[model samples]
Target: MPLAHPFDDDKLKEECGIFGAVGVADAANFVALGLHALQHRGQEAGGIVVHDPVHGFNSARRMGYVRDNFTSHEVMQTLPGNVGIGHVRYSTAGNKGQTAIRDVQPFFGEFSMGGAAIAHNGNITNADALRRELIERGSIFQSSSDSECIIHLMARSMGRTIPDRMEEALRKVEGAFSVVAMTRTKLIGVRDPLGVRPLVLGKFGDGYMLASETCALDIVGAEFIREVEPGEMVVISAKSGVQSHFPFRRRQSRFCIFEHVYFSRPDSILGGRSVYETRENIGRELAKESPVEADLVCPVPDSGTPAAIGFSLQSGIPYAMGIIRNQYMGRTFIEPSEQIRNMGVRLKLNVNRALIRNKRIILVDDSVVRGTTSRKIKDMLLDAGAAEVHFRIASPPTAWPCFYGVDTPQREKLLAATMTEDEMRDHLGVDSLKFISLDGLYRAVGEAEGRDPKAPKYCDACFSGEYPVAPTDMIEKGFQLKAAE
Candidate 1:
């Protein structure tokens, strides 16, 4: 299978997204709608599991987009129930490029208390060690996914109920996670103690829902309730309504700050802040940090539009759509020859030559990972007759790989890991390139005095390299951390 969309291969890949609901009739239908809204988070595979009084537990998983697989009447009809949970996956853990149907989630397992299905949205950093231990103790794994470890862990638990078993199962696992699980009578949601991933609670008609973002909740007409707190677990049923608990040890919440910059839907609300507004704030901060003179301020495309607007507003320059994206372009199934492959970003994006010709352009983008796409985009603009091109990035340089669910290449592959900012600009052949500082990024995300050196409010490990949790699996594999100054 093709690994990732050619245009997207240069960026950090989102891990997964999950949605669950209880006490609603035909819950699978709502789940499909929610997953459709969250399709951007993961496009490789999708699955849904539902529990009915008559049918017990039923599931349908497929290796494709939610719209292609879950929207069909034939697939939805098979998963008949009033309670359901769904997951869309991009495979951060096991079988990365070739995602098997077995690796698709909402993994189901039979237990003494009954059966339960779980959809996890973050990477379990300790999964390798746990998998080795579980296999030694006689646990049979059905899939290559690290998420399957949770099911095996639950089966071995001596707890009395499914929730208790799940709590027991998660205590031994480490790293970032936002999980949505289902038992016969309950819909459950839990976030890791640091809250590295996003999960929200919403109220629907007489029922409740949990999702990776508020945008999913809006897709099904669910009222926004609140974010599931860091380290908090909420169990919902028709009888009990919603019961909350603290299942993990208390620690300072370290929600991933990159969610504000890129991962989340622009319309979604996260951590009581508008994601779109925060992106705009990052642009304003970028302008303050690096002032430049240019004839036109242009965004690279859809992801850069909001920040470009903010940059234009702050600099009093006119914002223009210098680059246009082909919204209809989908993945190509057949392998292309060298000529077609060389087309690269041209297949997905085109320059608005009429407006940008002979103009000094300021290009606003979210972040630069490997600089491959940046070089291509700059070349495209220059070929379109732009006199000068400058890049204004919305986030700091990503110098470290994220172990908390986001799919990043090795440290050696990251451009920032090896090059200085000026060197990166020269390598990309741009007139100038500047990124927002870590302090500016924190300020844009509502940390007024900027990031605290002692106790940061959010996880900026990819930029600062101050990992909140040591990556146990990587350490075992001989990965090194940043040296102390």
Candidate 2:
């Protein structure tokens, strides 16, 4: 995860998800782009590893944007055959690594039992304790990522097959997780018992695919099949076809709502909810929840557009594109260091003075991670002649850092955790700021019922602090050792 690059945390990060497949012809490239579609979920590093059932596993992991990381021809050349998985990462200081590529996704392991590459999405709250338990048994780790702890658990499990060991290992690990692994001959996918992250299955001609979001399927031209049911274990191979293991509580399917609010692409469908529609619903509810007096409802660009449209429809406020986002700019501006990230923000967003001049502008955005970009965007609006700049976030303040696969910040890095809402408004220099109430957000996303089979109640612990799984203290120190480059 880019060796836990030092920089200010921005809007609550989607922190990159992953995608994979088995039996597809163009496996490597398809998975690469699938990861790219998930770039919004993460931006630090990206990689893919392909396994030939007849041969061995070949991995190409690099630390950079998808484009940069996969640029090396070797990444493609090394992936010899079909059946593969890919990952994009945004691990913080604690998850970043030094020379050990073990921290990289598709973490490979060979411990007398067998060898496999694991691709993970979501954090494991009990990671620290799990690591300590394994360490006490003289388990030596090649990486510090809490995700790698799973491999060790598998090694110790008394199961005969990889799937058995995997399922057994998973039973012992606690916290939110959705994972995909590739063995020498098979593909394995599993979601946490509580299902706090999103994972789905896709079909490409005769081949089967799985990814964090459906956008990956469209990019790869894979046929939309269905979502991997929460609390399900799917093992796919030519011999076994696709087998399922529903080892968890059926009521435990709690898909992360923030994925719809900010992380996924608008076109993507996360757990049957369209990202665009869900976000719009949030905006619509915002208007109903807290109507505001404003001249124009201006979105912060990209993510806020759909929500702004909903705001306009509900409140009769004119929605205008008051901010222009420079989509052409590479996520990695690449000058020298973190200070340059702020410079990238200027290049990325420009305020429209004509629209905001002397107007009471309400700026809508998805979520605020560190309040860095919000502060800058607000200053941009005020400087562009905004009279009363009001900031409205479509989602609630990210009060908690995700420990699972999502690239969550530390307790110290979360703006909401560190500062009060009133202090945040002052910090960002916005005349007003308000987050969608947790209840309002739930209703907007059709989660208030918590009865839908596909859309069961989820863990909004990041918001409400009611953890679904009994978490161990490992996650508190998961980042203490850091991930790899």
Candidate 3:
């Protein structure tokens, strides 16, 4: 099992990132760099598959970080092709804590049409049902990963071409998916109908690339073309350039709101808005909604920095580096003893004693999941002689587990699920704890009128408890939805 990071365990996790390149020399190298840029999306494992006209399809899937596993010239040499796709993974569906090498993706399948490799970035809501049906119909499963279902479905499709078969297969499956796939000569990218997850198209000279975020494209010096539209699929090849298709029935696009809050790199763009600017706006909105009397507005390190700056600007409070993060610390840092293991948050973060002492500090954070981190940070602040520690979360209370690609604890484990706002503040031992309201968040994300009850602009299921796409597998297992308000 991959060791879970001490701090990462307290927040939601994105499943994976997908990247593909077509018409570039040794495209696998480009894919590797793209995955490295997207390493924040997933760090447990990564895989790359490329097709050379002479060598056919070759793949290297390893269990670790992209730089650790895929950077070697030996591994890069093993995959040679002008077209390829890759994935960096953190298990959300199958074998969650025990991810196997077989579970690592850019999963490959041999077909009558030839061979295709696929890397997926979202959850399949009906995967269990689909897997069972496929198995009963004589499909032998390889990995426990829900993503393998796509390959099996493609095998059963009667369509002539690989893309045709993929289209046929995806129509039968339900839930969020942003898939990057490749055949011998072509690279493909598709986003789910609701645009629940992001996939963008980029151009690099004569070649083209597809990635989970625009930040990846920036790494390889690719020019950002545009986002792959909801329900749209693009097939790219050196010969044909790019072909677009919309196979799924149209619906109001519900892009994941959390991407702006935490998942994506702050440098990336989403919904035509800068993620960093949006987070800053979230802080501004939070300040307006919940004014606080504090001497310093301090961010909970990197993720909260932009929001903290906005909060400081809005409230006329001085922004300070109240807490410092050890940038050298990797997630895989070993704890040699029980004492060291118990010093979890301290391993990653430490309070700036001199700067924050005797100050009324307002700490801005992205979100609170279990409240474990919040409680510990508060204790640390008090111990460092801070007069007050107030938590101002940029996102709303996370009361519901996401059934999309995000890995979240059950409802019972979520702090916001069981406690009210005041209760949470009391439990965390903070002077005050406040989260931006759902409407405030919506407004920050460029929704002028806030979220509409009948029609929301983004998928905020984690905060709102109103899932746009029904979690079929969970519902069948007796998971209940929020009752009418």
Candidate 4:
């Protein structure tokens, strides 16, 4: 067998998640809970903004997991508003160049139309072009986020009202996105024409809400109404209730498949498919594609567990947790300098020497971007006396940074963008490595659907380099030459 570099086990998280709710007595508190449910989508930072009819507005944003950052009683007490929105961000548009408070969301803006707070989950690839146009027209920008570009475009468009201007601004931009904006009055929800991201409508008795995933709705006791139609916008207000509009009709619907495979919480329902079921299907598919007679089948850690179960069942191999993740690993941990930034990956995960020693192990993980973390994991397994470590990636290699809000490494840095599968195996020092084909992945997640809710056809551009939207300057600059589909 040809030995190439293999994928690492400590994969860097790149997807971002968002949530919004209104008409609830404690919208701010409700959103905080929702954000906690969607926390797995991001870990770098989290924030929530509430609009008070009489008290103007209050917002809170801090770096870390949603549970630690926004769900605290101290933090919730400070945010008081009946309408609110929250965000968990990963830098697809802007790296952590300026991790200042200004860059955080909901990116509150005070404009002539009104004070608006926005939280977004996808990237606007055309943001750079739009921002340059707005800059020429004398618009000052606060952050490098492509999300701000939408707001600038909204201000320039001569729409009669906030909703009209928002629709106009969305037209000028292109790419995968699901956004929730709170103007002084109504809470607005928008999905890109391609529906590259997810947006759902939910209800909580006298109030209604919109969130990135149904899991968020479950946290706050809001019953899921339905998946918001692709290329559609829904506005919720005290006077109008829930109003839906399709600013731009799309011939096809294409939501990101990674949400079910990796981005969403295991229990969440996205694109009408259960994330857990989709993951389980991935394992079933993996077993069929490349079944290995091993002593045991084990997942890298948390994310890959469900698929691991399916793999074990289909292949008839015993499933085990050969690796232990230190869930307490803080958001930011550095000894002192940038020289050892990747060191934390090891601290975050360790091998179960007792379980792995002298065993032929199959390690199934979600995806591999940079191979640095994987190399360490392989070494850890080797040191623990594993007889052999065969690796399998549940998804195809990620060759592109998700312009729709997922913060991944620049193109050149993405191992799959430059290296072939064999080359990657050699780098990561594994006995063998295989990635699930895109077709195999599609069937895995697709077969999991039962009925009722409609599902988008799925955009697999990160693994395929087939972006549904064109990238903006910041996206181009941030991701570099290898970033395209």
Candidate 5:
């Protein structure tokens, strides 16, 4: 069967997911389960590398879902190790084909010190420059991915141990990175200085785990330990247990706000708050900021469901399944071609003609990226005889593209990037449209006082464009940064 695209063809795509475990029997099995929980982060490819005392290191990397590739006993048997790391990848930098397998990670590198396999989440803003420098220094790159730079940097580092070399390597790196690496007997996890991405430490029996989200930990029956702090490197070994090192310079935390908005699983906990509750709060905030009188408050489905519920309660509008989504249809946004993506909305979502006909409907959705899906939904609702369609977005206008880990389109391609609220409503042919204000978004995420102009609570770069980390390579390559509106 041909692979289906992601659920929504218009939202930002998460780059990758990382999971690792040490001191466990069938460590690869546990890692596989953890990756399954994080499948939403990336769906293009999956890989696992395990380190067995007798077998040294064994690996399997395939371009498909974890269940299809790693669930088989045949594939799991090949990776027999007590310590391992795994990755689920989506192509952001590399080519998308069979040749891209070279970039499928849990990327293994053999240094003079030891052999290590690394899985990374988030983009390296300065990767191009680093890659160029590494190439000049006689480092032959095997893949087009920026993540390969980490391995090369570690290889050339003067530090003696793998952890030390990793720290040294990361010091030269600039951008958001949550990395899980396994070296012989040790499993390592590291978060960038700004904490742009998330990595958590979890405990399962006598073993330990490092994963991109708490949801991954839960899949392996691991107890929630604590998050790996920003600028911290956690080295887990049979002998040492868990040891932490602060390798990077100190910086304030700027966790990706989109995690709470759309990326993370609703059941997961982030920053001491439940993602589901946060999204509901976002709906409540939206209702307060942008209220519309309508017969029914409807969600775009799945992503919009929680907020629609909250909006219903807050606005006193009845919630109904005005639009239904096909659970079997994967994310349509991940489809390669524009033509497929253009047709994806119809394939994934259908209007409940009976419920919406001749009624004023409030359409609640998470975020509008290109506006193609929203426009199509509006047309569909009107065709079904809906008298009025009012769009209520749970998040602020997505005016800028995300460069960290999210696969967002360029600014020019974003709907909010070029149009005002009135223009967007007119373009979508909706009766009314309103987005949650930036302050309202902050409020919903538990920031009661709203965003601080000086030091924001979370990374809202996609909405605000005030990137905490400079896009160093882009700047060096003559890409001027646009000022945040």
Candidate 6:
């Protein structure tokens, strides 16, 4: 399979996707479908752990796409269970190699309570410190993933029950996490205090479902049963049905705003709003915030399409297919070298010469990261005889790297972290460039009055650099924080 999509190399990457099902017939099969729907969240590897009363626990983890690895009857037959949890991984904490498979998740730990399998969907910012502490105490780690810290923590907990152990484990951990886990009879789900990542509860017939997004629930024909509230844990089993526990100190929810911007699939619903509609609203906000005269408003394609349409309607510029993307290409194209990444863009996206010849174009994209892709696209448009290239970005400048779940470039590597709008425009050789203001983004995402200076509605750390969760590990490791440029 292709390593990554050319256009996506410049985007923030979500670390993983998690799904769990309890009291379902062919539980692994339903979990597989849920993971397939959430495939956009992570593509590196996929795994599922199921528990059968007769056979105990069974697991299968493999590198590459879910369809290639998990869709077979042979694989499904082995995972015979009524309760299961699954994970699709994209590495954020570990190095890439043969050993990387060891980090492939739905990481199983045989606790004294019982065998508990977990699929975690966010980063644990203080994991390094926790890992060291655990290791020094004779805890043997099986993988390099930061998520394994939870397993070890749970193992050491004195709680008599599995859920109690899990709650005790989470209370000591720090940072964004949405976790789905399973024991022989119960499936459990939890979101961090900030709700930095998403976890939703769903129901299908007598079974219960838990996933990162509503789209996954739709795939399994599950009814949306509200989100697993932040700092709350839900345990589902045949006997208990569903039990809810608020185990952490209550805090204001800080859902990752980037979920609407780029990470989530357009069809998914987040924060009670359709992701596609939210994106269109973002485009409308972008148009109102930064209007420009142009022959056409052209999207970067796929991720940028919804916003581009909204921009076209609001700006009165006809939308055109100026850049065509290779439909077969994956969301990410992992180039081993810079030389290949530079050329991969051309292979993935081709300028529509007939539509763009001598036309003034407004390029609408989600966000500009390193600016390398933007620069290449500008060159491509100029080469295709475009009279002018103006850029209208849907979100505010990404000035900080995410320590939550997203794999963001360091501060220095982020173009917005160092360069002014004019500087970026000059660097990309664009006629004009503008990004929607932070307040405007809030308005688009349904906060009509804009972001509250004191208590923001969502996590805008990547743009405003106001991190809800402290990067404790990074600070301890001597990573300096610079003011937003």
Highest lDDT: which candidate? 3
lDDT comparing candidate 6 with the true structure: 0.90
Candidate no. 2 TM-score: 0.89
Candidate 5, residues 1-485, lDDT tens digits: the string is 12435334577778899999999999999999999999998888889999998999999999878888989888999999899999987777334333378888978899897799898999999999999898998999998888889999999999989998889999998889999998899999999999989999999888999998999999889999999998999999877799987977788899999899889999988988999999999999999888878999999988898999999999999999999887876633343676765564777889899999999999999999999888889999998999999999988899988889888777789999899989999998999999999999899999999999899989998998788999897778675676556
Query: Per-residue CA lDDT of candidate 3, range 383-434, in tens?
Result: 9999999899999999999999998988999999999999999999999989
* lDDT of the structure predicted as candidate 5: 0.88
The models' CA-based lDDT, in order, is: 0.92, 0.77, 0.93, 0.78, 0.88, 0.90
Clash total of candidate 2: 22
Model 5: ten consecutive residues of lowest lDDT: 1-10
Residue pairs with colliding backbones in model 1 are none
How would you encode candidate 1's per-residue C-alpha lDDT over 91-125 as one tens digit per residue? 66345577888888999988877889999998888
| TM-score for each model | 0.98, 0.89, 0.99, 0.89, 0.96, 0.96
- Badly placed stretches (over 4 Å) of model 2 are 1-8, 71-74, 93-100, 111-114, 249-251, 336-344, 410-413, 418-420, 448-456, 474-485
Tens digits of per-residue lDDT, candidate 2, 1-485, equal 23322233565666557888888775787888888888877666777878775667788877767876665576687787678888887755455433245566878877565577787887777787788889999999887777788888988888888888888888887777889888766788898776778888888777888898898889888888788887899999856678998876676466777777877789998767788888899899888887889999999888899999999889999999999987765444445466655464677788888878999998888888888778788888888888998888888788775655555667678888889999998898888888888878888888665334333376666675555564567446453322223
Instruction: Let me know the TM-score candidate 4 reaches against the reference structure.
Output: 0.89
Runs in model 1 lying further than 4 Å from the true structure: 1-3, 332-334
Ranking by lDDT: 3, 1, 6, 5, 4, 2
Tens-digit lDDT track of model 4 for 209-293: 8888898899888999998888899989867799988999665777777777877788888766788988998998988988776
Better of 4 and 5 by lDDT: 5
lDDT (C-alpha) at residue 302 in model 3: 87
| Residue pairs in collision within model 6 | 4-332, 4-333, 4-334, 5-332, 5-333
